[model samples]
Target: MENRIHLGDCIDVLHEIQENSVDLVYLDPPFFTGKRQASSNKDGSKKYTYEDRWHSNSDYYDFIEKRLTLCRKVMKDTASIFFHCDRNAVHIARYALDKVFGPEAFQSEIIWSYKRWSNAKKGLLQQHQNILFYSKTNSFKWNKTFVDYSATTNIDQILQRRKRDDRGKSAYLRDKEGNVVLEATKEGVPLGDVWDIPYLNPKAKERTGYPTQKPILLLERIIALTTDEGDIVLDPFCGSGTTPVAANMLNRKYIGIDKSIDAVHLTNDRLLSPIKSESNLLKKGVESFLKKDQWIEMHLTGLECNPVHRNSGADALLKEKVNGNGVFIKVQKQEEKLNDALNKLVKLINSREGFKGILIQTSNTDEFINNESKSIKIIKSISMQIREF
Candidate 1:
């Protein structure tokens, strides 16, 4: 079945499908946490759960092995599977996957890492989960993907051609004339096994409050990496239907199976209208977020304002509203002309009605302007006042 969710045990549901019909399978099976994982809907109207508790580790292994065998039967020779789990059962799951898919089929052990605010019990915080990738055969489908290099990457490493020296060590290639050789133009760095995708926050639009629900972005990456448009994607343990929704967004056919009736109904309802949250962390690099201006921050310390990043017109916004409108603040730079700074602030304040603007003058090198309006206020910085005296 295409673009449908079946309400039954995955083993039984998978049996009805023909062999070698699916292109991709992504399963987030129970982690054998010995707890009945439960959560409520966004508005607390409904609760959804599934039993992850098993009799023993052997029972868990048996359960996973049987379903994986059935999943393999339905996957095409060029199909792939991604099995998601956490520390509670990754070892046992890996052993089971090796037994069912064979050692040659193993591809990667992807580590999905994210940030966590706090941890009560202390050793090292748990910030990552494992996704074991395997293919039905060696000729599985693949689509090349690339990402920007890290902020710490050396510029020379990217632009210079490298070769192995006599000792087999990496070295920059040089011509017979002793001139260094430049590398050919290149695409970005290839995708790595350790992913830094964020976990779903509480107010994420796609979050259905189902326990252990994954972010749509995470599923989208997995689907895009292995399948093409119009290809079939299957998720046997499709909690909250993230996989199917991701497949739908990418224009691929999808099949989802869950034993919980509520999960099946929720998955269907979500398909009617799917929502995805925008992640600032993914859109902008972490280095950008941490790239705060220390001088600007020091000047606005006692002003009770929020610092704005990458905005040409404003440096910060006042915490308190004036007459039900926001107050945008701009800190004048040492070399910038006074009128030029005023023009930038004026343009922003004029775009909206009732909003006010403040310009903090940090230098006296520019000519004084007598063009302050009712909506625009100009005040000298403490440094400027000290310089004047």
Candidate 2:
């Protein structure tokens, strides 16, 4: 089927689609944020917006339920639906979703976390949205994906074999002589429920001057996780056609429905030449912060290690490990003392991130303290050693 966007009330459009033909449905409807959601082009030459305000909470819930019910009608038995919403009416959305898809089919409540700069407000700054994942049935299609290991993962121990003892405790499998058994090679960790995707910035090349437009990367992940190539993905509330763009990029057929004439035109315009903003965060994974940190690069000279930037206490993640935990490295600053540097490193490792690190001795000191956890390995700098001699 050709990828296209339909214009009309989503509930009305969904009724026209062939039943049991859609493989996946992703929707990002109005969040009931009690205001008119609006955005404009980078130069402020164009603007787009939509109303999310309602007469009452009952009105909002009823509107959500009506569309959700129709969405379920067109989906195949093995299809899955991802409903995206904000905290304002997430409970209403979730309740309606459970009623339509059944609580037994609930797969996950995925949190889409992103960083944004907001002006000072009386309340806490909102940073996350909810995406309820539910399959039409238990036998839904799912494409398993793996993400890179965390900064403090026990890289070595991940490949080791383990067995349960008589007491039902998990321990490493050992031979008669007590040698640990090794398992076959494995991929990285499985994708988690929480996703850290960036919001569409005004400067982003993919931004289409559309209100509440989500990053294509976010839709790409949802499309990749549930549908394979050539699968039919449906989006009843496709704003600016993000779902269709993502589906088409992945070689999947898509049907997008929107009530606004402008939305349909923009979707068609984008599909003709689907431009995606490449995310450094996704390309480099979580480790991208490490590679981008100039401070870590300057300090970790001559050492082949991955610089970890997410963890504030740790500096460089050495390409090695001990006792199954990753090895990390921290260099003392010019104004910082040896103990202060070591304390920061120790605290990070003890946080159960499963990491070990070392304090690079860069100054003269009479203090010699031992890390009780044995996670920090100190390496004296050549300048300090020469001064001592």
Candidate 3:
């Protein structure tokens, strides 16, 4: 599974995959969006769009029921699936999923709220989409994502006004020995089901021309928080191949499928040109150009959190020799400031006997030395973004 796109119907393609192979599944299947045949080509050439149609509720259930059964077969015991849909077919889809994957496997229904351009007088604006998450087994991976609290929420103001304890931290009352014990606030609050992440607007850097294409950030968050690196991700209804693109960027192996030949070609073209910045949605497409080995190297240093070392030897080496994705130098106790740490790390990397490169995670701008500093090159981590020379 070294970055290849499959062209065919999802059910047929999924049947070819081995059982219990995929780690995660994120699908945004065609909603019964009645109009299937639209002018697809840029020059107004005639093109047929694959439309999902159902005459009755049972027909829709039958359609989803068979596909979900196949999806379950391909998923590992610990694998999870996210089905994105709207109100039109969500209930039937849920019923089919429950029958196929079991009710116990039902997870959260993520509400993706966004703005729509419609008159308010006629009816309430439909501004949210639904995503149903399901796991194959009880023992599954779930890394909770910490979304930043909205600025408009009153909770922020309430939190700010709370009194502080002697340690200068926000106070929370505790009941102990019939006395109130004030403690500091926890790191952050749990994210709720009603996510306020806006839909991909026209000006958004990640916007691809695909009408139903989702933001890469949403997929990235799901993939990162749900599974470990090197896990296999599958997207059967891979419209424009966003799931595979996100999986590759996050160092996950992936399988993507689509019935539309135009979509397949569009996805292929999108993956081929890695340097062109079309939009924020397309930035994740850059991962398509990276080889598995290159992805490994980038994953080692580029990820926000500490990279999950594959081997115990690598873990030991990292723990003993590296600090924050870089080989650390024992700077003087007083010289541990940002600038000094950068200089010491750079000097150590340059002085090393046989290392090819060094990645320094620091806030200082002086992390990089001249390129001519022997065979070693510098990589600096400013916040979560990494830059290499």
Candidate 4:
């Protein structure tokens, strides 16, 4: 099998991996939901109980620092990592990451902005999550992926202004141009720190049972823009396995680790039976199978009705028709349609002796199913009573 799941604590499992083996790492660790659940009375809302216990600042820092140190060991010198978190612990995680990976390796602090409910009634709405990107080397691979940033007409036009250089190269115009004119290239605009992807709502199709699961598209953009095919992808806290699935679908090898058994199972199922929307260009064949609506039907005729017939026509049909294997040959215009087509085919096979069957279909059929009986199997397409010897 090309894919396999390893169940254990992320920190312990990460230590077992070879040093400098991974090409990319993307992690979405648990956010520190500080001690306090707001309770609403008739008058107003007030903070009451704590939903999570790991609220102490020191405890939170230590939990992340240890995992990050182990993660650093498994990453290649040229590899890059994206650490995802919310406002609760993003600042702390950033500090820890800088310490482990070094300040000079700091790449980008991506702000994933989304439209969601914010409790900041007294202050500006909290509609964004933070993702700190880091690399082991300064010469790491970087591909600038872009998305349509047009919220309104004016904002779009202002952002859409193209710039080029004298050698017909597309780049941000740095200096004033003389008489030399440059041609605009087709390459899209460079990505910025602030990303505006749609938030996971109740109606979202990608919403699994997990409460904080992210969209596959977000991970896809990150993986595609940063790494190439056949590179290794690592996800230390792989929640529902979104990172691994995205990496595999993009033709990249992956290793995902999660402490939760449920998370591991969720990831396994997601990778095996990924939704159609998450299907990438490489999985076009799988998508085609799901969308197939037509079924193959085979018809056979002209066999002498005898208790023990050798190499007979009815025997041919029995040999070819099997369940779930795509072989659908049947007796042509047989009034004795025994209960179902399947049973009839079985009966024909049992009555015939030394009858060798052949498959007759207009199109090539995948060997999905095969039967021991040597009989004919035909695929159905049109309705016509034709005779066969």
Per-residue lDDT of model 2, residues 1-389, tens digit only: 34779989888888788888999999999888899988876788867787888999889988989988888888899899999998988898889999888899899999999986674877888889999999999999988999878889898898789999999999999989999988777678899999999887677899999988999999999999999899999988888999999999999999999898888988999999988998877777766655545444556788888766446577777786667778878887666788888888888888857677778877787787665766668888766788889
Model 3: weakest 10-residue lDDT segment is 308-317
Query: Model 3, 181-210: lDDT tens per residue?
Result: 433454456677876555766544454455
What RMSD, rounded to one decimal, does every model reach?
A: 7.4, 13.0, 17.6, 17.9
Candidate 3: C-alpha RMSD to true structure equals: 17.6
Comparing 1 and 2 by lDDT, which wins?
Answer: 1
Note the clash tally of each candidate.
Answer: 0, 0, 4, 11
Ranking by TM-score: 1, 2, 3, 4
Kindly provide the TM-score of model 3 when superposed on the true structure, using C-alpha atoms: 0.61
Please report, in order, the local distance difference test score of every candidate based on alpha carbons: 0.90, 0.85, 0.66, 0.66
Worst-scoring 10-residue span by lDDT in model 4: 303-312
Task: Compute each candidate's TM-score over C-alphas.
Answer: 0.76, 0.75, 0.61, 0.59
Q: List the residue pairs that clash in candidate 2.
A: none
* Residue-level lDDT for 313 in candidate 3: 14
- C-alpha lDDT of residue 245 in model 4: 89
Name the regions of candidate 4 deviating beyond 4 angstroms: 35-52, 117-123, 146-186, 276-389
Better of 2 and 3 by TM-score: 2
Instruction: Please list all clashing residue pairs in model 1, or write none if there are none.
Output: none
Candidate 3 collision pairs: 205-279, 205-280, 206-280, 206-281
